[model samples]
Target: MAMRKFLINFNYLNNYKNQAVRFLTTASTLSKNSEVLNETATELVKSIVEEYENKGKMFTLPWVDQHAINSALYPFKELLNLGIQPEFLEDACLHEEKLFRSMIKNGQSIYKMLTIFVENFIMNYEDSIRMFAKWCDLLENETPQSIQSRINLFSGRGLASGIGLRRIFEKCPELLFGSEVQKMDICLEQISNFFESGDLKTIVNNTPHICLLDPTELESKYEYIYFHMGFVSEELAKSKCWMDLDLFSIIDRHSLLLKTGKYFYPDPKRPQLKKENPSPELIFDTPENKFANLVAEVEYEEWLIFRELCEQQRRLEDKQEPYEKIKPSQRKAFERRLKEKRENMEGEIE
Candidate 1:
């Protein structure tokens, strides 16, 4: 048992060494435009790695599993502070431009795969906010300010700004900390509060929503939100839901949504620019996207009532046509009367 434990420890130490090397090497070439907060974080991680090496502790590769990496850097706390001004990391963090160029230049499918995953994420959350915060934490070491800024940029300015939250959660639900529902609700409440004192109309109208995640996942989540929120038909919802749930779904969905030409911002200044500091736009929507849902509910009810009526008629007739006894015109009349009766009954109590 002692020998086995030693082996595991040895492996962990090796991993940490590798991660330390990677972080330092990466930091050495970090762009001048890189966020100071993130750079500080990078420095912190490097320091921790060096300390572990000096102490003869085995370095864990990837560093996520290392207690020293987690504690010294403290993702949740440090990232939250950095978020206050995340724009500086534009050059340091891998931008979408490079992400796409890598895939296209290499003829790879990583971008597409990520999108489908993101779309299903929104649906899974039933569109809440808290879930998104947890997601951001897990996916990247972003500052809380950056997260909020991104959410505002994507969702527009309003009490119902959910695009940013949905976008992040969809892109990387695995990265977020909490269970799907818990995080989603939190995200929703926060966005709602952001718009509480302001006019939402200006935010959405001017800002418009954008998917900053890799295209595939970004598209998938966008479509999922559109479908479920009644922006698209229910038929589309089922298809999108399944498609968005696949691995690399986020990457795939993000691509597809952009392809559609339906989702776009009117502002030409920051077109396709996924920067933390955005040119502010006045395009907020009140109860954003809520109307789409109401239309969906109506469609759902119509289908449900039609199915129920068919079942009732089938049982009543024992497989024969219930109106067979009536003449064609009379049968039409009888059906119409029954439909009204059903409608009235449906309205009366339930």
Candidate 2:
């Protein structure tokens, strides 16, 4: 354990025999001269080895040989010099030299990201690598202010803080590296305009990856669901996962429900999917085989075909109308006749 502590102060691994001799001599004196010190030394030794192994297991690649170590020497030394832990280097880093080589040429971004992983979120080295590789492009453009905001954004939020950034990265890596910072600001504006101020945090808590969604597409979906369908922003915020679903799928399903007469809502009062609403899971989540019965289908494929037909009908409807505008007199007459028909049916029931 004393030897390992010496390692933090000195590069003894290259000439470990010399360091080992000194440590062993000290151990020998401690064992014979003081039994209590010897027992304390043993516990310390076990803790040192456990700490090393903890980080060593961070990444595992199939190849482990001297050659791998030889190739990784540059990065290993470079990271070590930068105060990075030795166990952070995975086997892949040793086998694949290009990662460090590229990093060496433009080490700033990589180093900055590494520090964030190590310090901010308490992420392992592998977690840093997964996120860095995906966002290296955009991260290169990130100012220090933007980087700090990014840190606070994930680490300070409620559910987002608990889940960390990995799930959002898995859901949408593009937000990290693919888009511009200005574009993200635009997206934020659209979200704020559509929903209440606090609802922004609510949406992120429900689905962090929604932050990366295209602003225009987000506006379209929000307008349809909130304005056209009469769903409020708060309801949408609770099920922000819906924003991640395919746009075409949402529209096609709505059309299918309308055709089936299972959807009934008058125009003055737009329908909403709320906590009180009784609807199938299809609207809230991507339907799987487990929910094949939601659409009265035996298989998911059949449900897909049903959506395709709805799409075809929708396209035909779009082509036929400049606007689906009806004359006021004609609309009123049709409503009156529909009311009479409903009244007659009620009379028959009576």
Candidate 3:
């Protein structure tokens, strides 16, 4: 009976020891988690303060689940290694798995660019997924090198190239996914005719997506600008202010100048219709109100008149029978007929 009792007491002691160890381990784990969460909260509050100051739209890691944090500490370390500011680091750590998978699919260069793209915006999990989806869609049938090259080209040209590659794609999807890159080439050639020297390279530098227009439609707009308004190729090229103007917009806006005698050529020597005499940037680069105040009174007034003229011009263009652009050959034919009529009149007089 004594030996059996001793064995039972030994067994009880062993079980107690095991329970004590487990309890200590559990307590240690909880303490570590509490520490991590507290730190995360402190950093998040600091980031929120920075956001209020406009330092950046601060994004903090979510600690609501607590389970994700215990899953792995490597993501938190990875976020640190990336040299991302604390403002963005926590959320980045939280989404580390998703970000890593996306990087694998998109390649490092594109992935890095995307991170830069979203670094400025404050986004939630869903926003991140949607942006990621957009990137995946853009990556289809497009090489990273090609996208980088275009980005470099636009950036070098002094345009808002770095605003975001996705933004540029959003505005003009055809440049990437469209089947007809050749059509844009034709558009460029047609638009080139309006420039005196037709420095298409320069034009592209100024406005990268201008070639998205249809060639013939761009042609009609250019003809009206040149012949009807008396703007020379070099003058138009110099300003490029009207590059994005719709059909008859130039005429409609500038007509007020002709009507009011405020119209004057940008060039003093070869006088024609008024020119903004500034970079093409003045039209789209600056805020309308800001740019308007800086330009000539006539230019500002012309801008104000544009909204009214736009509807009128659209109505007239709509009324035309199958609206065809008159080619140079057709213009020449009309000129020849006029000359023949003049000769016959001279003969009748004799």
TM-score of model 2 (CA atoms): 0.55
* TM-score for each model: 0.20, 0.55, 0.42
Candidate ranking under lDDT, highest first, comes to 2, 3, 1
- Clashing pairs for predicted structure model 3, backbone only: none
- TM-score comparison, 1 vs 3, better candidate: 3
- What is the C-alpha local distance difference test score of each model? 0.34, 0.52, 0.48
* Cα lDDT of model 1 by residue, 38-128, tens digit: 3444443344344445658544434565554444334312332423122222122222323212222221122222232234333321122
RMSD of each: 21.0, 11.3, 15.7
Candidate that would win on lDDT: 2
Worst lDDT run of 10 residues, candidate 3, spans: 75-84
| Cα-lDDT of candidate 2 | 0.52
Steric clash pairs (candidate 2): none
Tens-place lDDT per residue, model 3, 305-336, is: 66567676767778662233456668655445
Tens-digit lDDT track for model 2 on 95-122?
Answer: 3334434344345556666666556556
Q: Is candidate 2 or candidate 3 better by lDDT?
A: 2
Candidate 3, residue 177: Cα displacement in angstroms equals 5.0
Instruction: Assess the local accuracy of residue 277 in candidate 1 as a C-alpha lDDT between 0 and 100.
Output: 15
